[model samples]
Target: MHFDRKNYSDKILIDLYEALLRPRMIEEKMLILLRQGKISKWFSGIGQEAISIGCTYPLQDDEYILPMHRNLGVFTTRKIPYSRLFAQFQGKLSGFSNGRDRSFHFGTNDYHIVGMISHLGPQLAVADGIALANMLKKEKKATLVFTGDGGASEGDFHEALNVAAVWDLPVIFVVENNGYGLSTPSNEQFKFKSFVDKGPGYGIDAVKIDGNNVLEVYDTIRQLAENVRKNPRPVLVEAMTFRMRGHEEASGTKYVPTELMEKWAKKDPLQNYEAYLLKEKVLDEATIKKIRKAIQNDIERGLEKAYAEEMPKASTATEIADMYAPFEQKVVQPQSEGKNKKRYVDAISDGLKQSLEKYPELVIMGQDIAEYGGVFKITEGFVETFGKERIRNTPLCESAIIGIGLGMSIKKQKSVVEMQFADFVTCGFNQIVNNLAKSHYRWGQNADVVVRMPTGAGVAAGPFHSQSNEAWFFHTPGLKIVYPSNPADAKGLLCAAIEDPNPVIYFEHKFLYRSLTDDIHDDYYTTEIGKAKLVAAGENLSIITYGMGVHWAREVMESMPELSADILDLRSLLPWDKEAVAETVKKTSRVLVLHEDCMTGGIGGEISAWISEHCFEHLDAPVMREASLDTAVPFSPPLEQNFLPKGRLQQKIKDLVEF
Candidate 1:
């Protein structure tokens, strides 16, 4: 409710002061490196050092942290080697991210600086997840999540706050109110005067502090962190600080007024804290000078070491790329193997049933997934089979639905989350893109979660209900995207996705749920992720498609026996089988790409490009693409049919055979 200063021993005060100053020098060196062309451009924390150091001081060595790009002070306090920091800026081998991530996107699990996401607000969800995991593990630690006032505007921020509040997860969300997001000020970004005010709405304890005062920040975070560890509830601390530099090294302050800049510079957080130390007799003038000199020397040494270090070997790049290497072997069909046969939904039911039986830690949470057995009845009889504790029905908040899943996933539990519909997924986009995709890449910890959504435009569910947005996830790294058209593949892929070591987005075709059925084995089976399935073989043309589009192509192929059309279903999008696709194209001289997404910037574009580049000589004609019209999927039957890629398979086959 109110800010209070904590009394500390003289030695502790001096150590805090030194910690606060170390990052200031490092920030300066980074800017200099950028100017000298030794490193790429970066955003400097500058005057916000006090907040970064202050929040970090209270965190225990084993506690987790999720920082934004501007928290250079936090990185220094966590003891991330300054050389690795510089190497990251230089985009070299010694970089913490191995040159995969840009400057400011560094993370280290060993230091408990769990993760850092550059795109902003999504880190909040990750912080919530880490906190939830800690609680489940019974670890006496809290997670500190840092973001700017600008990031607070994202929907994921609200979702994370609410979920953390509901679960009473041990998390402290530190909002670095640095007055500007790029050039836009906080006042222009939100209707609320302070971000702390948004916390109470989510049932989180909220407070605001004078972020320029290092001691005030230190005291606030220390108490909040301790409270979180004890009570294990979410708290929001809005630190009102100032950004004394341009948004990034590439940005100029030409748009910033001279008078305002000068005014803020006079109250620079680092200088103000130094004055406070002197006034309180906590740090003498000589000690302050010595500390500054020591920090400067350390930074210089780090820079020299970083400059001398070799770039990450090209092999390291291949290794990083190999992390998601596809499982190449063919899936052994359950029915063919003489196992008991089951439907696609039955396989999902059985897999989850087995998961519930095998792993007591696993829990199922989503809207209407418990008693109602989900809107699609995919979870039919699950609540009865697994009981309410394992099968939970959450509130009608899509963001909250995903946020809870994220939290549960972090706890090392197999959390199966379902979005009622795929089109409504925009409500939880921030969670999927920012939190899920970056969790392992940013934190070096596996989320091991599965998100199942019924997708595709059919049954005239209308614009809102019928839409395929899998392309959105396909473009995002660190997330596995699986779209299974047949019941057998759906069940098998869903099982594999659940067991994956990473977060998986499982897209189930709504049109195929009951309308189409295949003979599947009763025993559990899993299709390899990132590997495509060749449904029908032909030599003339390869019709590469996924989800409902695959079914359409199959229908067209069966109708036109004279047209030799080979069909390949790419079940997984990211880490997709480029090798298999290239090989297939080499055999078939013509290729046609199809999907349910809008034609512009659809998944087809990427696939077409890949084929054209890798198997160019194998093509008999320019790759043909058929996708839904560049418009919202219509609700009317005729319009919906007209909007989709109807009869494109026949035309593609005709062109390929004739060519």
Candidate 2:
């Protein structure tokens, strides 16, 4: 086996041969465990050995790798310890996610591996963020991302590619064109033969290669990786391979024909590469046998050690996980001390401005965010102060931008992602609910992303542009939903959201942007989350509301000067001020919950339900909820006003008080 070291000699050939064989053996071990009921599932890279090994081996240890489920070779090539790898499969405490993720859906900061979620395309944007971090650090390190041909059809794939190419990021996207995506073949999934011709559309270099040929894949990817580091641009390499097995071991290959299966089996990467090494005299029969024996022994010992490790105790699962944590408030007095009369828009801007000054690495990204300062002028002059790098104007891809923010949040910078309009958040909803909201719970990953959503009707922006979507994320755990009432709270809460370790969906009322103005604090202070502000304290009735509803409740209370009533502005939605609501309900003996979002399934229902359960004895009347009628916001101004309960809050409050 011994040979020259300077070139691609016998020793290097044997090393490649061994690396290729290790993942195969590990999958075999996992399959046996699956049969024995020790493991649940197996996603084996049975036939795509060359594509994984060649593309991975060239990258430096510092460069991050965002791998998919079938990338067993990636873990082995990156030197992820076999003991921990087996422990993960067995759902033990010794694993990366401490049994939270029993599959290959686990990643670690230590290894710089951003593992996949079940949905394929989201990790592409995450990889983009990793490369963006590298670029920001002025490092030449490249980010390698792996996805299947089917995942290429995903929005995340397109969004990630566009950002990488547009920003000129150092990223090598290796699309393992393994003919089949789950059970669907490429013929039905894609219109193009391969993604090679598609890279130019996104301003990236493209290459197509024989995925089974280890040497060819290695040489091509190595050269591309070097060029990416030097010039810093996105490159797409489509490696054509075949899935010799089903999507998983449990999924039998009944859909695949026997002839097609036989054809790919003959062109097996490991088998072909092993023959190549033998022909090149990299190893003789004895040496090959010894290598195989050694690998088996090493795997057995690691597997034994992994099996002996303890499982995560049910009582202590969330010990290390950060979820639903309370906000820690800190007041910082301004050194110069200059207060300013500010509109709601100005307060949000100043809050962001103060946060930017506080944390220089805070990145603000969205459409029209750079020069235009957002469509509503919330971030005007932020680009000039923070520079273009910090204030990023992203393309109209909602999902990827949030995906990019998540990547940055995990890897380096604290980020605030604006949706342009709250309604458009549906485009990026998966990234928010699945990735951002679940990352902390799944793997103890910190999602320091603040999504600024401008919401509410009454601006005549119509359905697509105007809508309150707070209820969409109310059901998602690991998210902090803060909808502020006024300028002071808006600024203070934006700062607080940016500082929080978890994900915050900050809903700023579009109606309040210019309509609400007051003298705001010049210094930095975070308004406490999960706490209510007592706007007008009274004894007759209680109005519990947030966003534009808070002001409406106040207006309704003011209209009736003789009837004193308590108005509690719920600043946060997900962690709503339950204590304040209960106390006010007990004192006033009645409650009126309101919001701009539609009536059915709105957050108003959640509040009403909570109050009914907790304050049933204290209440003098059932909780009356006043939300917009269950319908899309109309374009007609008269219809829109009628659709929203802006003019009806007075009557709703009266009904609760009279009851």
Candidate 3:
């Protein structure tokens, strides 16, 4: 089709006008709602509406969109019902999130809109995965991700762009350079004059567009999206725009200079487009007035519907909470029966290999898992065995790795993501806490993903490399945490995790990786999650431990044979076996909890409190806990040993045995 600049009936121009106005009306209504206190908060796309709406013209219904908080424009232009969006603001049952998520956090699986992460930059990685999945599935869809210029400074943004470039995924990263990120302006936050400058380093095509010009954004994005779909390569589109309003309802224009604000207001995309439409005779003054009035009426009707919509009942939260609801249980037989019984690492390799054999959709990705077999060689020869298509190597982007895993999981593929070490998980905290952990709960969807991190301390690797931070995730809701203390349990739990429907954070203690010798069956086996195991039977005291602490406690038990101690290993922390712990405490009438993590807010504390509340009458002495000190793990062997819970078991044995 030849470009027709003078024709008002030109298909591209008409489409652009429709897209821009749709979001503009939504933004105007949102502002009114905010002022009336009908909506608690809102982030406006007042001036940058053209970029979001126009740039997305080429996207099909099957294509994925991972937008940021300021994407009301994109959603509105994409035909998401304004009533549903307003219901979200009111926390109603009819909202996209069913009242589980805040107003800005919206997602619709039917539309292939995965949802927005309130945190910045992480969605870039998520978009990469969606694009990668499209390529793998042989789908014609492309993935478009949007973020502000300020978000480009985040580590995840860089990580995701790099990976997408290397893999040549069908991704279009749109940077809405809307002058400011909250109160911080782009000039102050970024060192580069334009975000597109960094795209060359990642080997991706990059372009900067006049965000205020709807035609320019529409043309550029359409061409880029076409090229990306054909070649399945990544591209970066930097849309230079301006924010016409404060960041959110809570923000004020106190910090913004008056002259600068006036300049941007004069360059408003909506006003510019309105003039263009009038000058081109596409719409006369009467027609323009009619369109404005119609949009106003639509907004009013949407607001009325939203206000009348019922809020999600309290029972709804309780019902959804029932999914992760705790259950009471006594010691049950460990559920491990499989085709291959081998060491823990062997079990992992076999399970993954078997999964690949059974389901071609399974993919294993991490830093060194491809050819290096992982840091611990648990995935040794996976790349050569499974081929690069299934076993892929990722950059040193922890957040991107996990984020991609989440996206792939959402696409119905079993993705196993590994962190080089558990200590480095902090880099991916946003992906875990904000995106993966809460995705299911907030969006009423499931992310069948598995994240494995090698954890615990004993190798004198120091603070940065040697630390157990499971407590951080134990407190996080909607995440299933599993720690295996031995080879059998590790293999069994890993198998279970891969098959589960929810997100699982599987922590493999490095100290226990090859530390024990056990005869495992050669068949596939999976242990039950949310259950604890009774390793030994005793009468004096109950010792509750997990991971490497289980081994240390056992040694103490053997050393002090005079003290008959019962040992319980809690493999799962979030939905821990409270009933098992209570029963054991009640039976032994004394308890001692041990863990490798820091003492404060450790799993031991939660266990101790549960026992104290439920089995207080059965106790012979106060519940004692043995855990690492609050300080960081030391490099010196002596200091590290002293910082750990090595002597707690012996002391507990003597004290409890005497009692």
Candidate 4:
């Protein structure tokens, strides 16, 4: 706590003290609000303010911090207006996320800080991406990311650290060892002698610091920040501190030992810092009280405004559709260079290639994506063309790979991440649904990412390789799901997905990759999203499908030419154009919705329900749904065929038509 007066300016010392006080006061007011029932819940950082405050010193204009829930003091140090902060926590319209999210789950792009969600593990990779972006842009700026001991143990933590080190990214990862991971003690969290030891293993330089000592923490961060900016290497700094309270107010340390609580109370960062300042004659008692009073007054002022601010309307939660609104913005009416006959796989590759030509900042990454061109050879020659920086070959870590795209998209890289197989998406489901899908709604920023999911079966790739997993993403909000059935739609939709300003789940049918072929436009153009294609027109009935289902429906129609029906290819499901669906359903009174996924929870159910609700008067028969059985996609060719909707689709349509 002692510092030479000549070495450390009195102003710096006072600023650090104020930084600690601001968050403390905010947290105290939050506790009061929670008790009053004005705020629903709060994750109190309480005694751990020093780490959030201390490490934020000497922040440059271009620099940004990715903070955990506990790091409210980082806001104080970054000069985030108390008005927005208060409004955000209060779920008011003025909140950073427009009250779309609560607590530390909001962030502001203008403020240069991306807030963390409850699953904060993924943000490490995200921070690495932001830093990678700045490095790619040659910006002399760094991103500082904070995490707790619990988050440090997540898979993303190691993945991000290794990637950061390998890339020599300018990221300073600080782990706040606050004694507990929401009730679990430090001894139970890690067996390691020091968490800092992880740095050297990952090829990152690291250090452990006194988190409670504001001056020491600040000086360490300040010095390391210099090394990060100048040398551009990922650095790990573990800050030893204590929560000194339960995870949140509700927990109340009922399970925590009283003696352990007492032990940390004696080392309270606030009291110790005040005592140090007083002992060093750096701050008089009157001056200290005045500073504390000022911070309290500011908190009161902000809280009053927040209380007066209007809460978001009931409709705030609904209409959470594709972020790319008023679709005219992404219209690409580029000149076409005749037609080129291509397979579905090559068409998608062409789309990616053309997307890169248009979006200079576009990058694609996945397992064996670079040199090997992926297992399907869809990304073949992409690495050689885009180079390793743009076309990255990632390790076999789905969570980290998807997390990298989640971060890259936020950094404006317009990333396209391919899952080796759609079934493997389970590996990174947390990042996909929680990180990529929730980014726009939670942060009010553009997280334009295209996750190319090669879904569906025909390849007999078994349960772990082939899956009609569109149902999973269809249920999640804030994602644009595009499933193209042919080469033309695949090319155009993939192109549009890349340019669209939102997180898009592009499902490319692995079965149709090499099997399907068509002469597609060899020009830079974008297919309209949310709009379905009328593959064939008929007035007797309507057969709505997407992906491999389109082909199945087409084949059925060829045999049953008498049962004439309009085949509607719903290119995308998340933002399925309601108007288009209703028109088709109304025109052809009997409607059959089909999909390759299980019948129980398939997207066919949603479409069937919607048609029954919206086009009820126009219906000649109850909306029919034809889909695979509620079972895993079997490996055996016979079981797989029976598991698919294709075989039963014809009979189901006949039954519906007769009915």
Would you list the clashing residue pairs of candidate 2?
Answer: none
lDDT of each: 0.77, 0.85, 0.79, 0.83
Q: Give stretches of model 2 more than 4 Å off.
A: 1-6, 316-321, 324-337
What order do candidates take by lDDT, descending?
2, 4, 3, 1
> Top model by lDDT, which number?
2
lDDT string for model 2 (1-659, tens) is: 12222367666677778889988888887788888988888887889887888878877887889899778888889898889988888888888876777687878878778889989999999888888877777888888999998888898898999989899989899999988888898889988866998988997889998888877787788888889899999999999888877799888799998898998898898888887677777778898889889889989989889978877677543553355443465644445557789999999988999899999778889999999988888888888888999899999999988988888876768899999999999999999999998787667677889999988899888888888889999988889899998998998888888888789999999888988898888988787877888888898888888888888877777888878878889898867887888888889888888888999999989889988888899888888989998889899999999999978887777777777
| TM values, all candidates | 0.85, 0.96, 0.94, 0.95
For candidate 3, write residues 1-659 as lDDT tens digits: 02235433455676677677877777776778788887778877778887777766767877888877767667776777778878888888888876877766856777677667667787788888777788888887678998888778788888999899989898989998987878898778987888788888888889998888877777778778888888888899999888877888679767889998898888887777777767777767887677778777877788788888777668866755744413333323334543333566665666567656756887888887877888788878777778997888888888998889778866877788888888888988889888887777677666667888888788988998898999989888878899988777777787777777677899987776666656665555567889999998898888899988888888888887677778999988877998899889989888989998989988899888988888899888989888898899999999999889886658756776676
What TM-score does candidate 2 reach? 0.96
Taking the tens digit of each residue's C-alpha lDDT, what string does model 4 give over 534-581? 999997888888888888888989998677889999898988978878
Off by over 4 Å in 3: 1-12, 316-341
The TM-score of predicted model 1 comes to 0.85
Predicted structure with the largest TM-score when compared to the true one: 2
- Selected candidate, larger TM-score, 1 vs 2: 2
